[model samples]
Target: MTDHEDDLGPRVASFRELRGMSLRALAAAAGVSTSFLSQLENGRTNASVASLRKIAGALGVSPAELLDERAAHTRGVLRADRRPRLEGALGVEKFVLSLPPLRNLEVYAGEFAPGASTGANPYTHGNAQEMFVVIEGTVVFELGGERFEMSRDDSIEFLSSVPHRIVNESEAEARVIWINSPPTPDEAHGA
Candidate 1:
């Protein structure tokens, strides 16, 4: 295998393992044959775009994430301008503060314009833990049917499995820092 392919195989295998999926399980989820997946993971074959998409979908990540060269590097200090921004809801902007190999943790800085929110519906992740800290302005978080209002310097942490949504009702823009442990794969795609 070429160097790139060699690097890709281990990454695919590592992500699969991190999700606690066996080869057969991942193959089934990705709608590919177990043998084919084994070959791909062993660097014996390359994946087509369709296959990569399927694999990424099954892993709850974007194909771009699987293909990112930077994902292979571990940068100790990420510059402000170098941080990757995430696609968020209207009036909300999110920037990733953490670097590659996002297995254990993720940190993000978010700015929410007035009246912005994480939508009306609440969302949930698997078993990850999350913390949100308000840097400026005020925001409210609704978690598991309870509402909590937070202001500058205030923080909250909880299991991400609980249904939650964030809201900025103030007239001013709100800024926050979000930290997650055992980062959710969907977050990798800015979901």
Candidate 2:
């Protein structure tokens, strides 16, 4: 197996431990065999994409998060120019504002061009908390089943599990800061 597969095993085990899940419990939750799970965790075997997805779901994280190297170490200072930028979807651009090895919290900065949006459909995370602060212009946020319009300096905090989407419906571009507690399961690669 490749080195990444070997590294993946321990990371999966770590996340399982963080969630206070036993091998059997996680195996059952992911609908995988205990032996297979053990072998995967011990680096004796590699996992397929579907297996990784199942395990990540059972661990309350995204598959990509389980494979993220940035989640393994902590950085004290994050220079602005050094922030990692993500290849955004739609007209939205995102940057990781926090240093590596995200533990309890993560911070991000996003810019949405006029008429841009997070996506057509809302997405949900696991049991975490999120805060969004509008830095400039205006944006509309749909959280749960309600829609809230926010302007510069406006902020809102909500459960990450709630289905949500952000849209920049204004004539000008909008900027926002996104903060997540207990960090969501998304990978951030630094520039």
Candidate 3:
């Protein structure tokens, strides 16, 4: 295999994880078999152009984004307008601040409309360390069995595995930031 082919599998795996897609889920969306996707992700096989296109389409990214390794490794400025917004629960806007090939860390900036929330129920992710900082307004954060009301500049650190949710009960919009070390793959694409 060529160098690009060697790197393709890991890249596919990473994007799949980032999109919070299971192997079966991606396979179904791409109209490919689970074993085929697994083999492709494990570097045991390569994909045809059609297969690559389907996978990229399912991931909501272009084929070039999947094929270009430099897009993930290059040091460049990510303009504000170009930041990728994550689709999540209503009234909440989450933007990924970190670039591709997320390695040790990931960052997200969030905006919550009045009375907005992550969801009615709390959720958890992988075991990475996480930190949430309130940039503006107030928000109520539920972690495990406890609840904490945080305001501007207030920050909380916890494991990503903890069940947590954020609510902006205030009358105005609330802004926040999330930082995770060793990037959490589960729920990485959304909240």
Model 3: residues with Cα > 4 Å off, grouped in runs: 1-74, 186-190
**Ranking of all candidate structures by their TM-score, best first:** 3, 1, 2
Across residues 28-57, which tens digit of lDDT does each residue of candidate 1 receive? 989999999998888889999899999878
Best by TM-score: 3
Per-prediction TM-score to the true structure, in the order listed: 0.59, 0.58, 0.61
| Residue 21 lDDT, candidate 2, scale 0-100 | 64
Q: What is the lDDT for 47 in model 2? A: 94
Error of 3 at 161 (Å): 0.7
Total clashing residue pairs per candidate?
Answer: 0, 1, 0
Candidates 1 and 3: which is better by lDDT? 3
Of 1 and 2, the candidate ahead on TM-score is 1
Per-residue lDDT over 124-190 for candidate 2, one digit per residue giving the tens place of the 0 to 100 score: 8765788999999999999988999999999999988888899999999999999988777764221
Return the TM-score for candidate 1, rounded to 2 decimals: 0.59
Task: Give the Å shift of residue 149 in candidate 3.
Answer: 0.6
